[model samples]
Structures are given as C-alpha cells and as structure tokens.
Target: MASTQQSRILRVGLLQDGRILEERHLRRPGDLTVGRDAKSTLVLPLSEDLPARFTVFEYRANQYNLVFSAGMKGRVHLGSSDVDFEALRADGMAMQRGHQYVLPLQESARGLVELDGDLSLFFQFVPPPPAAEKPQLPPDLRGGLWRTMDRVFFGILAASLLLHFSGAAIIIASEPPPEPELSLDELPDRFARVLIPPKPEEPKPRAAETAQAAAATEEKPQSNDAQDKPAEATRPANAQEAAARRAEVVKKVEGKGLLKILGSSGSGGGGAFADVLGGSTGGGEIAAALAGAGGVGIATEASVGATGPRGGGTGNVAGIGELGTSGAGKVDLGSSKKEVEVSGRVTSSTPEVESSDVDREALARYVKVRLKAIQNCYEKELKRNPSLKGKVMVRFSILPSGRTGDIEIEENTLGNDAVGSCIRTVIRSWVFPFKPDDEVPVAYPFVFSPAG
Candidate 1:
C-alpha cells in the first residue's frame, strides 16, 4: 500500500536528455499552471506549438481538477492510457497519490527540450488523523472534602508504624547477658598432672668382648720405621700398587681360564692340580697364587705357614678375603648400545570429489528472484519520465561459506543514486549453495528502459 503522507504534497519529477533535471514540490491548495509565458506558474523553454499557457490545475474540495488550454495540440496521459475528459466531466475522476502522469510536447527550440521530451508529475497526500475524546470521572473523587480525609488517614497510619518499631528496639536493648555453665576450678587431678615432666634414664656400658677387640688392635707391635711414619703414609702407596697389581693378575688369570680352573679343581677332573701347579712342585708358583687371591704381600709368610699347617694352603678355601663372586671384579661399561626390530604396514585411502561449475542459468534464476525485491525502486520513477534508460553493473564475490561480500558498483547510468543503491543492496544479500574450498566472482549487469 502507498503511504497516506505521500498524498499530502504534489511532486514534479523532471527528466531532460536522459538525465534528472529537477524535482518540485507543491504543499498548498491552489492553482498550478505550466506553459511558455512569463506569467505562467511554471514556465517551460520556448516552443511555437505550445500556447502562451498550456495546462492548468485547480485544487479544491480535496481533489485536483486538470484541464488543457484552448489552443494546446498535444495529448496528456496517466501512464500509457489517454486521459478521458468526458468521463472526468461526468463524475470527476480522482487522482491518487503515488500515480504518475506524463506530458510530451511536439515542438522545441532549445535542444535540451526535444519535441518528444516529457514532463513527469507524481503526487503525495497526507490527511490529518482524527482527534480522541477526553475521559469522564465521578464527582465524589473530584471534591475537596474526600481528598483532605485521604491525606489525614494516610499520615496517621504512617506515624503508628514508626512508633511500633521504636518500642521493639527499646525492649531488645534492655535484656541481660547469658551466665556461664562451668568454672575453671572444677577441673580433675589428671588434667593437673599433665603439667609435670619425668626424668630421663642413663645409657648401659659396652660389652667386655668388644673392649678386648679394640685394645688388641691398638696394642699390636709395630716396626720402628712404621711407628714413626703413621697410618696416613701408607694410603697412597696401597691405592696405586693395588690397582696396577689387580689389573695384571686379572689379565693373567682370564687368559689361562680361571673359570675352568675353579670348576675342575672342585670336581674329580684329571690334571686339576696339574693346571694349578703346572705339573711341577713349584713353590714360587704356589706363593704367587696365594698372594694374588689374598690381595696382600704375604707370599713368603704363606709358604712358611703352608709347610707347618695341615697340608692346607693349596686346599679349597671357603672364604677368600673379597672374592665371593666372579662378577664382583668385572669392569663397568657406562652405556651399551641395543638393537630393536620393528615392522609396520601402510594402506592407501581415496576421498570423494565434488563438481565445481559456473551455471549461468542457475545464477539467472537467483537474479530473477532478487530483481522482484528491487525493481519497484526504478519502476515508480521510470513510469513518470519514460526517456531515462541505462545499465548498472555490480561486481561481487561469493565466499566459500555461501555468503556474498565485497559488493561494489562497477558502473551505473540510471541517472539517480537511489535506484543504483537499491539494486546494490539486494545484490549484496544474495546467497548461493556452498562450494567446497572455492570462492566465486561475479559481475552482473542490469538494464533499465522506459519500455521495460
């Protein structure tokens, strides 16, 4: 529906040479005239076929009365239909707001106004809305006596509430504090005894056997040179010599198969003592074996002790100082390399593909739907002056998410900004079906003509 406010004013929208010339407004109810004369209300450019005055409009009784001058030769129209003056005379045809009327002159002097040039007119009317009535009330509420009584009763009730709360505060402030349930003097004897601490007991003396062992080590006889040098003097010498000697012994024993010797010596194997003694009663070799196993320089003492003791220095010794296990003397390797084997299988996969095509027919259908929403913007203006015609080219991009953006007018020749902007806004809101991983660009053209 057309707006009622549009009916309140008469608008003359003019177009000359395919461009907008001017727009005129008439808000008052009076006579309007258009012609070539200086005395006319609206003077046009010079033309011989046009009389001194060509047209007249009278606004009376909220209706416009239109008529042509006596000598004018051209025809006037509401859209494409010819005006029926006879029917207008019979009942006075009414002109509605938002409707367009056109006039084409046959003669022109200024090339600006051609013989087929059009003078277009559109109207806007706004009738005032009706007024509303005031509401009525009872006479009792309006009188002064009841109003005074209402105020006095409300004041009395407020004062009573204040007094009642003030009395409650006074009663709460006058109450006494609570008494204790028990006193500290009533506690029992066990609680008092916890304050005292008990005395500690003395430690027992050491055993006599342990005291004898300590004294024997302390009283052992020492040589004159050893007693003078002190125990700290022997530490460095022992460390260097022990490390070198132990390494030499380990190399010799490992090359001669110490594990095989130990195993055969304990078993009933032939030549077990032959391997240890090398099939000869060699005292020097026996002395060397005793010194290596004991980790001490007592080879001569061991030979003398063996000659006296139960044929025993070469016999199986259950415990040899630190030789409890074979692995105990093995060299440490910090980090060792390890080899791991792993095997795996791989499988191939195929993904689905989608079609990507620029369908002009599909795009045309979408543009047809969009055109219905914006064509009226140009139609209402184009209907008045039929000569104005041009094209609007809009460039836009469709995002992967199926939304339109970056809309811009590449070209516009519609002669007015409103028509171009209306079409641009509709183009920016267009949505197409989503294309996977693709962005589409579009440059669409729209043409407008009086005939269209």
Candidate 2:
C-alpha cells in the first residue's frame, strides 16, 4: 500500500484569495517548502508578513505528514469526517513541536491550510499522468535536403528555370544586329540635302509698288486713246481752240437728247422737274389753272438762291440743326457697394499651456484664437492619411515686443513631420497681444482628431 501510494502523484497547489498561484506534482517522496523566497520550491510573492520559507508537506516512513505553525489554521479531509486544527489539537490527534503542529496524512487525505487567512495551500494525492509521446518525421524525409524535398516540386522548379533560360537565349540569338557605325565624312554625304541651309525667302512687294501697277493697268486704255490722235494734236494749241473744242463736245451731247432730258433750255420743266423752272413769274397763274382744271396744284415756289421765307409764299422745309434737349434730370443709382459674409469653424482639443511671465489663461486664449491655422496644418495632412490623429506639443518664446521666436516642436506623437513643421511655422508668425516684461517661455500641446 505504501509503495502504491508513493507510486501515485502528490499534487500540491498554492492559492491566494481563491485564485491558484502556483502548483506542483511530486512523484518521489520529499519535503515541499512554500514561502516568499526565490530558492523555495513553490515561491510566492514577496511580503513582509509571510515567512521566508516553511515546510507544508513532508514524506517520511512511506507516509505523508501535514505541517503548520501554531498561529496557522485550516481543515483536513480524512476518511469520512472533516477536522479542523483546533479540533485535532483538542482530540490529541496533532503532534505539537514547540510552536509548530504536525498532522499525519493518509494516502486518500486532501485538505487546505490557510496562512494569514489570505494565502491557502491545498494538497491532494492524484494518479500519475501518462507519459507524452515524442513526434517523429517520416523515413523518407529524415536525411538531407535532396531526400527531404518533394521530387515533383523540385522537377517543376528546375524545368521552369531551364525554360526561362532557353527562351532568353533564343531571343538573344534571334535579335537583329545593330547597324554599322558611320564616320563623320559618310554622315555628311549621306544627309547632305538635310544638312544644307535653305535659301532666304524673297521679300514681298511694297504697297506703293502694287498701287502703281494697278494704276498703270487702269491708264492703259487712256494711253491707247491718246495714241489714236496725232501727238501734236493731243492738246489744244491756244485758249480759243480749247473753248472751241469744249463747245463742240457740248453740242454733240445736246444733239443726243441730253440737254432736252436735263431741261437745260426749259424744255422739260427744268432739270429734275423743279416747280419754279427758270424763275418764271407766272407761277400762281399755272397753279390756279392746274387747280381749276382738277390737276395737281403746285405750292408757291421759292427761288434756289433764296435763304429765308419769301413774302406770301411757303419756304423750303427747314433743315435739321441740333437735337433738342430732354427735360429729364440725372438719375440716382444708389450705392454700388456690396457686403460679403464668410463663415467657418475649426475644432481642436484644449491646449495644454505653460507660461511663466505671461498669464497662462491669456496664453491659452491666444492659442485658441489661432487654432484654426494649426488645424489647417493637421487637416492638410489628414487628407493624405485619413487615419492621422494625435498630439503635437510646441515650444516657443514670447519676446518683450509681443512677437514669437524660437518656435519648434517639442514633442510630436502624430509621427508626421510635415504637420509639426507647418504648425511650428504658423506659431512663429503669431504675435501675442500683451508684451512680456522679459522673454516668456511657453510649451503648448494641441491634440488632433478626425471630424465625423
């Protein structure tokens, strides 16, 4: 029975606050120590109240014994009843050694020992676990790479490489040879026509010459007419001869009915049918006779030389001089000015600001007002990487003149240098409202998040 009990495994576990912390299985008879020391078999967390080391289970004389100090307390399960340490002491079942208590355990015993009412050690006897089987490779894959690799895969790979190389070689062999290089002398002769410079274009004729050519063509007929006459007779010899020639030309024109059609001799009621032909004094008589005979009556006619209204006669229609003025005054078009409204919003996390000389709140307000520029920097990058969102801390100095200087990114959690650089540039351009007594050092953080 003792051999059989030792053959079975002794499983001991340490638990704290109902949670298992460490567990071990002992196959051979031995002492099990539990404590907060590193050298202990079952080491626990370091605690000032816990002892450095203590034995909880000891195997001797082919029997296991449970051990505990006097202050320790717990219960044990043996046979058919549950027994506490105090009960065991009162029944004289536990052996006292100075301040330690020892209780002999049976092969079937399982119990819990509580240390400081917080740490618990549970021991029980369990069957030994079966041995684990070792993994083994196949016989064919046990040697070198040549034997281990799949034959079909290796063949396919080798064939593919061979086919690629052969195809490349065939292409190289079939390629056409490059053309022979030409010398400079041969090149110039082969492309002589292309290399020759073209001749300069002829300039177009001027406007004056073109006009003279057209005039000469038009005067060709006049020259021909002059040629028909004797050169000496082309012009009249004297004034009387010139007048005589003019009169002859006029007489020939009148003989052709030109003077009669023009009413030059008052034969056709004067030329162009003037009502007062030749300024005749019988105008009223003609008008009255036409009226009495039911013919069209002609109004009193003024002489062509008259400039004003004639006595008892309707004058020529008045000539239009200048346009008359309109009575309307200038119009009022009101104001031409226009008003435009622009609106937008920029969202950002509250800036973590620090300043020595300047008021921290005022500095924060100044940063808040300019957050739009910083937001623009972040949004510009956000368009490229939509998932970009993080914190960027900036450090700058407020000069005595209210201008910013020494602006730089102190910390950047966004991992993007562009945003940090852009923000630094923007902050450098800012001017605080209040001038500091001395240079004020400031560090501000701005958090960015993508808007929904």
lDDT of predicted model 2 = 0.75
**lDDT tens digits, residues 23-46, model 1?**
555555566766678886667667
In candidate 1, stretches whose alpha carbon ends up further than 4 angstroms from where it belongs are 1-357, 383-385
Candidate models: Cα lDDT each = 0.53, 0.75
Question: How many residue pairs clash in all the candidates, one count each?
Answer: 9, 0
Error of 2 at 46 (Å): 1.5
Off by over 4 Å in 2: 134-452
Where is model 2 poorest over a 10-residue stretch in terms of lDDT? 283-292
Q: Per-residue lDDT of 1-452 in model 2, one digit per residue for the tens?
A: 68778578789998989999888888777999988888788987777777999888887788888888777789999899889888988787999878888898877889998875578888888998877788878976678887778999999999999999999999988968899998767776548667886698999999999999999999999999888788767789999998678667755765456434643435444333233333443433322223334543333325234534434465564333433766989786976776432222344444444445677777777778777888888878877777787788777888889999788788888899999999888987887887878777777777787775
